[model samples]
Target: MELKKKLFPFFSTVGILIVVLGLYAFKSDSATTERYVAQTRWENLKVLPQNISKDSLDYLMKNYALSLGVKCTHCHVPSKTDPTKLDFASDEKIEKEIARGMVKMTNDLNALYFQPHFPEPKPKQVHVVNCVMCHRGAVNPEKYLSQMGEMYKTYDPNRDNRKEMFLEQQKKQ
Candidate 1:
């Protein structure tokens, strides 16, 4: 019995050490795996930038706009070609209005829900949303089609004859 007791404690300590070491190894391996995945995605993005359809862009823009609680006109000027044009494209009027509205919304939400419950003197920092949040990687067609169906409605296959072109390209491949 005495021998068993001594051996039991030693075995328990060794088992715990093994588990800790295994977990450490697993965490290190996961980091390496994530790095490889990121590298692959970067390569794919470089090669496939042209394959990104307009529907995909619209979907990304819509989600990004929603996140910021603003409309598309905020970033893209209606019927304007050059985004840098200060008159309509980069109008300070629209930017200021959107910024003020966002600030007000964030303040209101924080004051109502976060500030009262928490003893923190300062209110929570307002999160300014952006495009890269959801569309971090290559465009997901299924998500794009579902989210921004309206943008794709006017996409006439006859205009570009992309269906025929795709078939010809596929046969060549």
Candidate 2:
């Protein structure tokens, strides 16, 4: 019984040490990978963190991709010199510019709506809207009023007579 008691304490201490070491190794390995887009050297970042670590940047990008059901190439364009590598700094892709605008819009909406205005009592959450709220893992969300599709028809905004004349000529033939 005395031998078992002594061994038990030693084993417990070793187990705790092992767990701490394992966690430390995991955290360091996850954060220290070489990043093409460095946290400090970022440019053209409008909505996302201007100074974000590589791991954090990757984490956020993954969430955004999952939210929209898209790959990174949906917003970021590949380098012309090397198609495999992404041109992170370039805004040659119009979608990237549009994404910045979308981020701003969503943040603004959250600021206005999601924030609680309780003076006396504090609320639980600062629950803000994310892209996933609307997207639900889709590039384009399915229309709620799909049945009313036929009701809305395109009207020609032909203020000039040229478009009308062109259609009229086509009818005669």
Candidate 3:
């Protein structure tokens, strides 16, 4: 009976030591993994600015869209393989038309309004818009749903009624 009791305490002590060793190993491994990941992320961010070229931008945009769980079709017309599609919708058939229209609008604004007031050069580059400009830090599903819901309510399709409703809502804020 005494031998069994002594063995029990010895086994218990060994088991506790094993558990403590396991926990220490696990914690060490996790810290090492986190540091490795942080280093990799830091390297990626360092290279990102240097790697930003026309070809790289195209690749990055596609990858960025994928990372956001969307495709170029979300912001651009799928039917038009070209970047400069008239309609930004998925089924747009016209090119140059929408692009030209946007160019003209921007030009008119710059020539008549902006140049006279601001003394800035007319924007020479075509502005490629993306999701991040609006979404910013919002990465979760619930946040997206809530933001989209609010946007829809503010810009509701029932123009005649909702215009006043939106204005009233805006005024309240």
Candidate 4:
């Protein structure tokens, strides 16, 4: 009766303190975890500029991942001994090779077309095509614009006859 009433408030306060401390511990541990540590260290970057800082590399990599609606592991293979550790230099994943081709294609497309017609000078330019132009934050774009997918499926980039075909089509029109 009296004991229950007296201890109830103390027990409740102690329980809440325990829970708060546990939550704080979890938050702190996660904040200092290996993923955060890895983000601070960079090595063996091949495609991007070798002089690029870790922060810039991380930002660009994150943007690419978000553009494609994928996680780091989508193009990276994790270390067998430490799952949190990624082999950034490894080309084990085919998606990584595809991404490189996409980057080159985007650069070529921008250089050949949009850059020339710029109303303003570049290093200032507009209407540049990036992954987001078609991807819209997806690996495979959503169905509303699936014609883009069909076009890509039927088109052969390596055939190198795109310019000829475009001119032929224009002549018909």
Candidate 5:
């Protein structure tokens, strides 16, 4: 009975230790698996981080859609396995390449102009320029000549006169 009492405490401690170790191993394994899964989740990510969370990627994609006034089909092709679904990794559409270039440009601009002055007070009201700055909720932004023509009403450019011709040609309405 005395030995049993002594053994009980030792066995209980060992059992508790084993359970704790098992839980820790499970947690570590799951964490590693999660990281591996995250890395594999994204394919053909030339600009965006491959390990970006689904929610963050979705939010960014939705933002891009709104900014450019386009749907997912504008840049993504239909999946081979599932025609109804988009193949996000596919580069079948030229628009995707264009979009990637635009993303790189925005990132470069932000890094050069806005990001460098961060945490400090911004020099201007607009700290960063994004797709919305140029796209203005349009798939193709209004021509610069048209915008300038509308703004100035009577300013005619004589340099090649292409702006004038573009301005006179339906004025991009």
Candidate 6:
């Protein structure tokens, strides 16, 4: 009885130490596992940031498709092995290159014109133009000329002075 009583405190401390060490080991292992699990490494990333979140990248891609009146297949090529599934990493399509160029152009435009220059930035909702502004759900924005007027459709700047013609038309309006 005396031996049990004396060993009780020592045994209790040993058991508690074992449990604490077990918990610390479990926590460390889980943290290490989580670091690898949380990372999503993409294959090819050129224009956009490599570490961009999947949701943000998807949103941006969907916007491009919507703006150009195109589907995922427009920019992404179908997988050779699986015909149904898209291989987004493949730059086989010329459209993808064009899209990259357009993205770069918009980014440049935004930085040059729309981005705030002042140290004390004005609290204004400054509208930044994007693909939608020019494309407007059309694959070719040149089609917009048909809706503008017949003069726009047939007008050749080489022969006719565009500035003079536009001024005259605006004056009549």
- TM per candidate comes to 0.23, 0.56, 0.23, 0.55, 0.58, 0.59
Q: Which number leads on TM-score? A: 6
Instruction: After superposing candidate 1 on the true structure, give the runs of residues whose Cα lies further than 4 Å from its correct spot.
Output: 1-64, 67-72, 75-89, 92-96, 119-123, 126-173
Candidate 6, poorest ten consecutive residues by summed lDDT? 118-127
RMSD of 2: 10.4
What is the TM-score (0 to 1) of candidate 6?
0.59
Report every candidate's CA lDDT.
Answer: 0.51, 0.72, 0.49, 0.74, 0.79, 0.78
Pitting candidate 1 against candidate 6, the one with the higher lDDT is 6
Q: Clashing pairs in model 2?
A: none
What's model 5's overall lDDT? Answer: 0.79
Question: Judged by TM-score relative to the true structure, which candidate is superior, 4 or 6?
Answer: 6
lDDT of 1 by residue, 34-129 (tens): 655321222112212445565664675466556545665654454455545523224323343444444466557656766677655764543333
Candidate 6 regions exceeding 4 Å error are 1-37, 117-127, 145-173
Native-referenced Cα lDDT, model 6:
0.78
Per-residue lDDT tens digits for candidate 2, residues 41-141, read: 67777777777777878987898899888999988888889999998888766667666766787777766776556444655434478888877888655
User: Residue 124, candidate 3: how far off, in angstroms?
Assistant: 1.8
Which scores greater on TM-score, model 3 or model 5? 5
**Candidate with the greatest lDDT versus the true structure:** 5
Q: What are the runs in model 4 whose C-alpha is more than 4 Å off?
A: 1-44, 119-121, 124-127, 142-145, 148-173
Estimate, for each residue in 7-110, the C-alpha lDDT of model 4 and write its tens digit. 99999999999999989877755545755543333465555667667777788789889988899999899987788898877876767777877777887788
Clashing pairs in 5: none
**Segments of candidate 2 deviating more than 4 angstroms:** 1-39, 118-127, 142-173
Model 5: per-residue lDDT, tens digit, 1-173? 99999899999999999999989876656656666643346789999887888888999899999998899999999999999999999986767877888898888888788776777764433338899888888876655335666678676644333334644664566
The stretch of ten residues in a row with the least summed lDDT in candidate 2 is 155-164
